[model samples]
Structure formats: structure tokens, C-alpha cells
Target: MTKKIENHPIEDVFGDEICEGDTYFVFGNETVLQSNLKQYLIEKQQVQCYEAI
Candidate 1:
């Protein structure tokens, strides 16, 4: 899971903010891609998440 840095706005390709930890997850095979990362940020920690189109 990623954390947001204050005042250092995070944005998508179109310049729209991607809430939650300002992050998104896709099907990958990397060690850092934990299955619960997205869910944890939203459900467990209750962060405002957005999906990138």
C-alpha cells in the first residue's frame, strides 16, 4: 500500500486525483503487488479509492 504525501498532489494520466492512497492495482507478478493492497487501503483502512480508466 502507498501513502499520500501532503500537498504533493497525486494525479492520473489525465490530471485527475486518484484518491485512497492515490493508487491503483493491476494484474501483475511483482513481489510488491500484494493481493490485499487495494482492499486493505479501502476496506480495512477506509481510504477513498478511485479506479483509473
Candidate 2:
């Protein structure tokens, strides 16, 4: 005999992005924002280090 697996609700699986910061973290993984890049450079003062990471 074979057993079947159940799936969780979509909301439970995906969670939620209830604020701007939450949304940013969710989508930011796939794309680099220009302002974030600039701020990183200004804070680090080294482009090579950022690129290496």
C-alpha cells in the first residue's frame, strides 16, 4: 500500500510581508537596488571588497 503526503496552506507556506522592510528582504535576494549599492560603497569606501563578497 502507498501513503499520500499533504501540503500546507499557501499562506502558511509563504508567510507574509506585512511591511516595506519585509517586502524588501523578500524581493531583495534576487535583485540589487541602486541606492543600496551606493550606500554600501559609501559605508565601506572600497568597491573591490564589495565585489569580492
Candidate 3:
């Protein structure tokens, strides 16, 4: 099975409930990193991290 990030902005999913100081978790395999939105959230926003199992 393939897991991917939604091709939309985080606000689309979380609505206005999410804020800069709040932390949220997105679950997916390493492939999720391939997504531009996900990559930007991790790299540019510095809100996500990767862990190898």
C-alpha cells in the first residue's frame, strides 16, 4: 500500500484550530517526505521530524 500526504494545505484539514505554537502529528512512511507540502513543513517550517525504525 502507498501512503501519501493530502494534496492540500494543513489548514484545509485542521481548519482554524491549528496555530503556530500548537504541535500536530502526521503519520506516514518515508515516502511522505517526497511531498512538497510535507517536505516544506519539515524543512522550512521545521515542524516535522523523521525517525528510522
For model 2, the run of ten residues with the poorest summed lDDT: 17-26
1-53: candidate 1 lDDT, tens digit per residue: 56545554344323355454544443342211244466555754589997799
Question: What TM-score, computed on C-alpha atoms, does each candidate reach?
Answer: 0.32, 0.20, 0.26
Comparing candidate 1 with candidate 2, which one achieves the higher lDDT? 1
lDDT of candidate model 1 versus the reference: 0.47
Instruction: Report the lDDT of model 1 for residue 33.
Output: 26
lDDT of 1 at 36: 48
Task: List per-prediction Cα lDDT, in the order shown.
Answer: 0.47, 0.33, 0.43
Q: Where does model 3 exceed 4 Å of error? A: 1-34
Q: In candidate 2, what are the lDDT values of residues 32-52, reduced to their tens digit?
A: 233354544455446554355
In order, how many clashes per candidate? 1, 0, 0
Model 3: per-residue Cα lDDT over 23-49, one tens digit each: 344445211223245655766568967
The deviation in Å at residue 45 for candidate 2 is 2.8
Candidate structures ordered by lDDT, highest first: 1, 3, 2
